[model samples]
Target chain A: MAIAALAGFVGALTGLGGGIIITPALTLLFGVDIRYAIGATLVGVIATSSGAAAAYVREGYTNIRIGLFLEIATTLGAIEGAILATAVPTSALAVIFGTVLLYSAWQTARPGPVSAAAAAPDPLAARLRMNSTYPTPEGPRAYQVQGVGYGFGLMAGAGAISGLLGIGSGAFKVLAMDRAMKLPFKVSTTTSNFMIGVTAAASAGVYLNRGYIDPGLAMPVMLGVLAGSSLGARLLAAARTKVLRALFGLVLVFIAIQMIYSGLKGAL
Target chain B: MSRDGGARRWTDERIEKLVGNLLRAGVLISAAVVLVSGICYLWHAGTGAAEYHFFHGEPSPLNSVSGILASLRTLDCRASIQFGILLLMATPVARVAAAALGFYLQGDRTYVVVSLAVLAILALSLSGYWVR
Candidate 1:
């Protein structure tokens, strides 16, 4: 529980949900089964996402319209991924998870520009009213959304990865919104955070039905992540997140390598 | 300046606030339930006994709703934990439902349909309709 709490704090600070840390820790340090770890990590993901998003939504950084619209794709993809989870070999899942982790590491290492391009909005985005404003210290900042199709496709893929691995897949979501959709960085992050809980919940339902959600394992993880994220939100202003993020990114790379090695050896 | 437009904004804010608080409260209540149940579970089964290396298949007797409910009636710790997790899972579904209502009230047909589609997918997952 304490480790989960720490993982949640780091995840919240890093804007990656706790599952990334929790899954690797459970599998590596505690000798927990990958399937059980994924199940427990899903609960933790929901806890942190929902707990943190409550504030983000009220703060207006989260674009509710975009979140709801994108969820149409994410939830569907999550269901399909959950169905696949039951049949896919665990070793294969580990390899895929490791690849995602490495990609996330590269993403973190090279932060992309928050596209302020004055490009024309997609017809679908305009029809859906995907353009929105986010509150800033100065005032409300307006931004236009573009690439609706690409963003939706990316979100569906992110949701599939999330369902399979039990992480928020926030890196991909942020990439979709910030790069493809051309939303501001803050809006993209908060909106991604808001969307993750629902995305995870969709898959969690399937995991629950599959009996992957063991109460004995999930209870502590859920409670621990909730407490940790709440505390992390409080400490965020004081924490030097740049250094912490770099350190965490390194940790992710290391874990990714380990996961790949284990998967290759059929020992995951 | 129209009353309809003014009312629409009012309802939108109301729904957003309600949904935010609903998510907050759901997490808190479910976390509390999980905490207490965890404590009980830990007391019953010592912490050091979990063998993480082995794959112990599905957790039986608490896999289905009926099974969880039956166990919960007896105040079983594990069942309570599962129930709390269930409540946590329900939070987002409830949020989507509330958002759909919000869209309907705002007369936004596109979003209403979108939210309902998301909800339907979630419902399908929960219904175990896709189980093989």
Candidate 2:
């Protein structure tokens, strides 16, 4: 539970999912099965996403209209990925998890893309009314959405990763929204948080039906992450997130190595 | 977006506030249930981390929606905890349903259709479509 709390704090601080820490800690440090870890952490993902999103939604950072439009692809992909989780070998899942961890760490180290070219609007985006303004220091800044089709495709992949790995896919979703669709980083992150719960809930049902969700294990984890994340959000203004994010990125790398090594050893 | 041939009953702001309340309330209630059930469970089950590290699958009652409800009459701590988790899971599903309603009120036909499609997928998954 304490570890899960820490995971949530770091996740909120670093814009990473708590599952990245919880799953590795459960499987590597605690010797819990990866499958069970995934199941339990999926619950935490829902808790944190829903809990955090209320504030975001009310604050108007969440583009509910845009989010709903993309969710069709994500929900479809999530179901497929959840079903795949049942068939995939545990060692393979570990390998995939490690690879994703490395990718997330790399993504964390990278800067947000500057999409100066995104001013041009797509007919599809305009027709769908995805173009909107977010509040900035100056005023509500209008931004045109480009590449709706491409962003939707990436969102599908993000949902698959969310289901298969039990992470929030904050990195992947930002990649779709910020990089592909050219939403402001703030809007991307907040809207991603808003969308994550629905994506995870799509997988949650499958996880439950597969008998992977252990209440005894999930109870503490869910509560701990919820509390810790809320606390982290509160403390966010006081903390130096740049340094913390870098340190967390390094931690992700270390955990990734450990996961991959153990996975290879197990496979052999 | 209002093409519904009438004044919309709920403004987007009001609906957004409702959604925000729904999400927070769902999480809090579920967390309270989990916390109480967890304390009761830990008191009875003891803090045996060793056994819990293994992956022995749960029984049918703990694994299915109907089963979770049916077993609640017995007041098993695990079942209660599962029920809490079920509520947590339901929040987002309900949010999607609420979103559909919001868009319907706003008369955004495209978005209403989109929201319903996502909700249908969630409903399918909850119905054991993947598992069966």
Per-residue C-alpha lDDT of model 1 across residues A1-268, encoded as one tens digit per residue: 8988987776666556767778878887887888788889998998988888787677677788899989988887887788887677768778877887798778766665544566777888778887778776678887888889999999999888788777777767877887788887667766887788899988887787788877877877888888898886566444453565576578668768877877887866
Error of 2 at B85 (Å): 0.3
Fnat per candidate? 0.74, 0.88
lDDT of 2 at B13: 66
| Chain A TM-scores of all predicted models | 0.89, 0.87
Docking class of 2: high
Residues A1-268 of candidate 2: C-alpha lDDT, one tens digit per residue:
8998887776665445566678878877877887788899999988878877877778666788788888887878888888887677767767877788798778867765554454677789989988777766577788888889999999999888788777776667766887678776667766877788899899988999988899988998999999887776566444553675576568678768876887887830
Which one is best on DockQ? Answer: 2
Docking class for candidate 1: medium
TM-score of each: 0.91, 0.90
- Whose TM-score is greatest here? 1
Please identify model 2 stretches exceeding 4 Å from their true place. A100-108, A113-118, A235-259, B1-11
Q: Provide the clashing-pair count of each candidate structure.
A: 1, 0
* lDDT of residue A233 for candidate 1: 58
Model 1 clashing residue pairs (backbone): A31-B52
